[model samples]
Each structure stands twice: as structure tokens, then as C-alpha cells.
Target: MGYGITLQVSGDYALFTRPEMKGERVSYDVMTPSAARGILEAILWKPAIKWIVDRITVLNRIDFESIRRNEVGSKIPPRNVTAAMGGAHVDLHQYPSEDRQQRASLVLRNVAYLIDAHFEMNPSKVGETDTPEKFYNMFLRRARQGQCFHNPYLGCREFAARFQLIDHTEQRLASHYADIEEMDLGWMLWDIEYGEERGKGKTMYSFQPKFYRTMMRNGVIEVSREVGL
Candidate 1:
């Protein structure tokens, strides 16, 4: 366990796209744990520390809205990009007029959540001067001052998120959906686990996406350590 903090995040629209729906975009009812960690990292992150989401509190009703967005059908191939970078005269540009396609998306609207999380020091990346307390205090200061390395978004870059540190002393009321005792969120995407191995004096990295059966009780989703993150 490390120092813990609460952050309140709100956005007009959010799209935590479900992998099952390949063609159309459909968002989850609440923010994903990985997304919450990304928001915290955006505010303040260092290689020595990694954010762990303990729980999330939904502060607003989940509502979905349908919209159509213009998107490109395909992306420039890596081979073409490499050739262009090497001055081999390859066209790596994607013109909207030729590749434009409108896709329907079911996204969440007027969303707000309280993220309860903490940072754990990575011993492999920590230095002699790097301390958990130092990074924790730095995170608090930066979050309170409204500073972030980049603009934080709610799942999608276009749906910008606004965040603020929650004051523990301030009395706050429960959300409208707080009365609901329990709700099953089905299998939800947890996070991608990166594994690195060294063989033949070379290092190889692999990414594996993980999913867990998620449930919310009294408006709070408690992430379990037993899941092996």
C-alpha cells in the first residue's frame, strides 16, 4: 500500500469502446480502471512510480447517446511509412475525401466519477533519491494546481475531461444511483499486461490484455488484488 488520493473527473461525453462491438462503438457504463490510472498518470507520473486504482465511485447517472462520426477506413501501412521516412518516395497520406466513412457510436454523456487510487514505487526503476512520499506529495501539488503533462480525455481525445482533487474534510453527498445495492457489469477490460524477456542477449516485450468480471455495489467498484491485475 502507498499514499492514496481521490480525484473527481467529469466530462460531457465518453467512449470506452467495447471490443466485442467491432463495427460500431459502444461505451461501458462506467469508466474503466485502466482509464482511471491513465488520468492520474497524465496529471503526474514518473518512471519510479505506477498508479493503482483501488476503487471508483460513480457520481452521476449513466446515460448513452448515439452519434455518427467520420473516420478513415484504413491507416498507412508501416512499410510505406518506413519507405517514406527513408526518402524512398512513398505516399503515406490519407485523404479524408477518399477514405471517409461515418460510423455510429453509442457513448456515455454527462459523466462524473471519483477515482480512489494510490501509487506504488517500482523498485526496478527507482533511484536513491526517489521516495514514495516525494512522488505522492508532488502528485498532490500538481493535481491541486491543475497541471498535467498533457490534456486528459475520457477514453477519447475529443471528449476532454476536467479533474480536481477531492478534499477529505469536505462533506459530500452520495450520487443519485448510490441506492442501487448491486449491479453486474459483466466482463470488463482490466488492463494490458506487458511482459519482457531476454534471450540471446536480446529483449522482447509482449502485451496481453486482461479482463475481469466487474460488479458495482452501492455505486462503488472495488478492484480486487486477487485478480492479479
Candidate 2:
């Protein structure tokens, strides 16, 4: 069976349990669309169904610290690796062809800014009551205004610098890998359901590492630097 994975924004999330840092790393889910389309293709075998993504929901916008402490370990490599390669380690076990394709999926490599104006809740006046409906609405509003930029071959740090999103302090957020299972993003959910099919042939996919290579060159040279090699 042919396959493809896509990511979409889910909803707004509070970055931290504490008040001051609550809105820090706030971002979106970025997930795969519905299975209905894929299912239809499986049943009907239609070529036209190829390369279609269903939807993108905004799960939550969380704090940067949480992203670092939680996701960095597993999602990325150790500091030594980063220092040596200027990116995550490359696992040679992946499907070289698929790995190459993923490098071009802008959505996967791009850095997305949590558009605070659309997603962050307005501070309540002195003694106003808050409700779930109000909170959910806030997320929806932010989803409408959410924005992201894709750097097909660049790491998070370089991508952020190129786009002027943050100074060095926020630089780590680009490569920090955290445990996003609780967030219910496509990667986490699919891992639980399909047992991580992507990893079946390889220990890990190659997108992140390839992105690293692109970043190290200061955005000058890319994997596909040659005209059509």
C-alpha cells in the first residue's frame, strides 16, 4: 500500500502549568488529516487520491521550556552530536528514497510561530469568570490567525535565525525533542495505533538529520545543490 503523512495545526494549548510561563512555547499540533480519504482509496483504488492531506487542527500552544525538557532527549540527539554535526544524528536505516522525499515536505521542516494575538486568551478584567467554551473559542480564533514558515533543508535554529523569530536563547527550541504523546499529535497517535510503521525499516526517519546538514552550510549548500543530481 502506498502512504504519505501530513501535519496540520490542531489547537491552542497552555505552555506551562505555572502562570508566568504558561504562554511561552504555545504552538499547534500539526497532524495528518482524516483516514476517510485514505480508506476510500484503499477500497476503490483511485490514483487521484494520491498526495492529498485531510485537515490540520490546532492542538495547543505551549511554553518553550516544556518543549526543551520533554521533547529534546528522544526527538533529537545529544549535545555532542549537535556540536559535531550541527544537527541530529543520521540513522542510515531509513528508506533512502522516502527520506529524500521528506526533505522536501516544507510543512515538516518549517518553523511555525504561535500567533499569540489569535490564540492567547485575553486577560480577564478584575473578577470575570472563565468557562471551557470561552477557552475553546480562544483556540479557534488563534487557529484562524496561525502562521508558519518552512525551510525544506534547514534545522530549527537556522530557520529561526533566517526568519528572525528568536535570539540564541530561543535557538534550542528548534532542535529540542520532547514527549508530545500527551499532546495527541499525529506522530504520537500513529505510533500507538500502527506501532510506528515508519520505524519498521529504520530506527528513525531522516528528515531532521537532513535538515541539520542544510542548516550547517548557513543555507548556502543543500543536499540537492547540483542542478539535477
Candidate 3:
């Protein structure tokens, strides 16, 4: 058996950057499954369980807004930190004045979504006393109280999201696109998978991003469980 939750998430701005648009940040037409899972983890995350987003309901009409800002182009290299950790003095400071670049972003505005998701316990990680009901109750209590490990963001950290846990029996409000039929969303990022057998006794440091072609049916998107590239 699986325990699921329905949460209402809203934000003033969101930037779910498209992978193809390297120069400028361009958002997808709707929220992606991975982003929905991130919001759930922000509320309550446990290594013993994995969250699966089942569906996403777009509550408000999709709106796009463009903006430009000064941003850092790159981050400090990890090798520099490694050298500093070994007692060698290294310059690890980032100079915003030097790295700052003007960037444009196409973002979503006044976005709201209802995310329905469930969690599955990992047999290898779950303790003997850990039960589905235990975790379900924990999330239920914390979410209802508006408690989260960190403030959930829409996509970028700058745009914070506000959430409310809806009772399972409560009537869900109709979506803004309820009257509309299906709309193709093209290929969207599903999630990233990390695990590759390198050589003997070597750590898996590489990852692969997965994607899928999907559509929104009357403002709702059903997340697929099938695994593929």
C-alpha cells in the first residue's frame, strides 16, 4: 500500500530552465515531475523512502514573464577547494564584479499547482520500526502546520513557494484550463539517475538526465512511472 498527499503550491515567479536554452533561461510550459518531487522533499525527506509524483494540476492560467538580471556565469572549481583542504593556500573567493554577466530569463508568473504524490519505502534503508503510516503521519502533521526543512522554491531559490496541505476528502478546486482539452508539452525532463559501474572500487560520479514526451489533459498531467532516457 502507498500513502499519498495532495498539496497546493503557489508562487509569484518560477524559472524552470529548459536544458536546450544554454545562453538564456527559458521555462517549460508547465511544471515538471522532478520539480514537483523537489517540493515534496523540501517538506519532508527521509533516505528510507522515495517520493513519486503521480500528477500535477495547474490551478492558474499559464503566464510568462521575461526579466533580466546581473548573475554569476560560473562557480569556483572543486579542485581549488581540494587543494585548500590539503593545507595549501588557494584563492577560493568568487568576485561578483569580475564574473557578473547580464542574463535574461523567461519565467512563469502567478503560478499555482496541485501536486499529488506518494512515497515508497526502500527495503534496504528502512528500519524495522519504520512503517508507511509513520512517515505518512509525520508529513501530514508537518505539512498542515506549514513546517518544512527549508522554504520550498518554485524552481529557482529566489522564487519562494507557499504550500497548503489539502485534506484527502476535501473537494479540489477546478483548474483554470478545465474547459480546455489536451495540450502537448513536448519533451520534458523527468528526473536524473546516478549510478554507473566504473572500474573496480571506483565511485560512481557520473549522472544521466531522463526525459519524456507528455501532454496536459484538461490542466492535469499524469506522471509516467516507466523508466527511460
lDDT of 3 at 210: 94
lDDT of 2 by residue, 72-92 (tens): 212233545546565655552
Position 37, candidate 1: lDDT? 93
Q: Considering summed lDDT, which 10 consecutive residues are worst modelled in model 1?
A: 220-229
In terms of TM-score, which candidate is strongest?
3
Query: What are the lDDT scores of the predictions, listed in order?
Result: 0.90, 0.25, 0.92
Candidate ordering by lDDT (highest first): 3, 1, 2
Against the true structure, what is each candidate's TM-score?
A: 0.91, 0.17, 0.94
User: Against the hidden true structure, what lDDT does model 1 obtain?
Assistant: 0.90
Error of 1 at 126 (Å): 0.9
Clashing pairs in 1: none
In the order shown, what is each candidate's alpha-carbon RMSD?
2.2, 21.9, 1.6
Return the candidate ranking by TM-score, descending: 3, 1, 2
Deviating ranges (above 4 Å) for candidate 3 = 85-87, 196-201
lDDT tens string, model 3, 64-110? 99999789989989889979988999999999999999999999999
Flag regions of model 2 displaced more than 4 Å. Answer: 1-130, 146-229
What number of clashing residue pairs does each candidate have, in the order they appear? 0, 29, 0
Model 2 clash count equals 29
